[model samples]
Target: MAHKKLQRFQEIKTFPNVFEMPENMAQRWTKHFNNQHPLVLELACGKGEYTVGLARLYPENNYIGVDIKGNRIWRGALTALNEDLHNVAFLRTPIEQIQQYFFPNSVDAIWITFPDPQLRLSKAKKRLTHPRFLRLYQQILQPNGVVYLKTDSPNLYQFTKTVINLFGLELLQDYDNLYAATNLLPEHTIKTHYEQLDIAQSNRIHFLAFKLNQTLPIEKDVELKKLIEIHGTD
Candidate 1:
């Protein structure tokens, strides 16, 4: 690792708001925030712009940014500490192991911001919107809890919508051109570094929010698989 990254890794260890493989964390986030506020998770939270931004917007709900990279987490954790954002925290761990850390129905909502599109069919399972990953999310998410996705790739946006339809998941909002809307929410206008870069490159940013109330069995859905295999090429 670079010198700066090593320094950040060491620094994050000292932050009381940051946890690395903590135990007794399941359904116990209320103790961390010192209130019974609902918890929201930002997965694959690179630099945690969403975590910091949303925490500022809604202090009533606690926010935790989860990513395997300690260096990226350092920025958000330190910012929360410095700003005295009590509702903000960072979890340094792989998103795949989330069930081990959080109990069922512990989370109120999820946000996956600007994640890699995982454009290839072979890498479909790695996409955060993939059924396997959704199942992992549902394990800890409360019933009817929303999972939000904000991304620069149009492919991921459409792909997630298709998956939601095929799996009978509720599609609460679908903004193909999120910024084009006349009445945009505050969260929609909060741009991340990647979002700014995408705008400069003329790549459209997409947003999708849905509820995973029912089971999403990708194996049984032949049509969805073929759709992925076909449309995943672009």
Candidate 2:
């Protein structure tokens, strides 16, 4: 592994603000904070910009940044420690294993910020909005919990909208062009590293928020598959 990555692995081990597959994970988490504050998870939280940002915005809620990369997680973990953000924590784990940490209905909401669109049709199951992941999210999420997505990829934006429609989910908010509107919400203004480096240079940022329907059945969309097959995606 890279030197920085090795160092981060060693460093985060001691971070009071970070947790890595801890014992009694769920019980300890709620007790550590000594409150029943709503827990919000940021999946694929690269460097935890949205995690820390949201923690700062909503002090009443606890924030956990979940990502597999120790090196990337170190930045946000240390930031929370340095700033004394007691409610902010980073979880170094693969997004696929989220259910291992939190109990069902324990999480209040989820945020997926600038995640890989998994643009290719072959990678559809890997997309964060894919039915497989959504089902996993639903398992742990509170009833009617909302999933918020912020991305610069129009394909991912539309793909999520399609999933919502296909699954009969409740669409709470949909901003195709986030910056184009006047009165941008504070949470909407937070930018992730990927947003600056790859997506925002030319493309407009998009925000999608929807609630998971517990009874929604899973089915592949042939029309969506054809769309991905015909046109390339961002």
Candidate 3:
């Protein structure tokens, strides 16, 4: 497994769809896709399933899968190239630095599928939906640009709700059990390997779609910390 991982890491460097911290990446995006289509990002896109899936569903839009693991992205990059998914691309970078690669108001939407819940209170800041990450998302996301979260973790679902409420973000949609809900869209149909494993063992998938506020206040972060300390049981 180690040898295979090393080989994939070396191989992805040559892939036309993969970019690893390339300088002035924001300027190159338009040239890469050769169109002025809307940009959508799938953060923590393990295997780039959602990224590729969304691109396939919406040919009018461009999708980029952002993850730090090269070996994991190799499968999606290869699949995109093999299938000629011109709208699909992969970026190798930590989610924390996501804003650095995209210019202000450049991103149209974001999807975070099956990300780590960061159940421990001590790790709350690391959660993708945390205020810290939201601030980063706000930097690049267009005004009222939607952010979607799909997870099997009840804790994460509730935690994100708290952040949205506390931060005054617009909650466009919320579903505690996505499969049990009606009028599901095409994007909801895509599932990753981790989702199949049911790692959370919660059986139900939670989904939240929201828009960030114009500004995520710094003072509210202090309040958020206090609330988590008092009420956070996970």
Predicted model with the maximum lDDT: 3
What C-alpha lDDT values do all the predictions have?
0.86, 0.85, 0.93
User: Could you tell me every candidate's TM-score relative to the true structure?
Assistant: 0.94, 0.92, 0.98
Task: Name the lDDT of candidate 3.
Answer: 0.93
TM-score of 3: 0.98
In model 3, the worst 10-residue window by lDDT is: 225-234
* Cα lDDT tens digits for candidate 1, 1-234: 699999998999999999997888775677778897888999999888899999999989999999999999998888888899999999988888988888898899999998888877677778899888999999999997999999888778878988898888898888888888887889877777678777425356778899998887667456777987776622
**Minimal lDDT window, size 10, model 1:** 196-205
Candidate 1: the clashing residue pairs are: none
TM-score: the better of candidates 1 and 2:
1
Order of candidate numbers by lDDT, starting with the best: 3, 1, 2
Output the worst ten-in-a-row residue range by lDDT, candidate 2.
Answer: 225-234
Q: What's the lDDT of the predicted structure labeled candidate 1?
A: 0.86
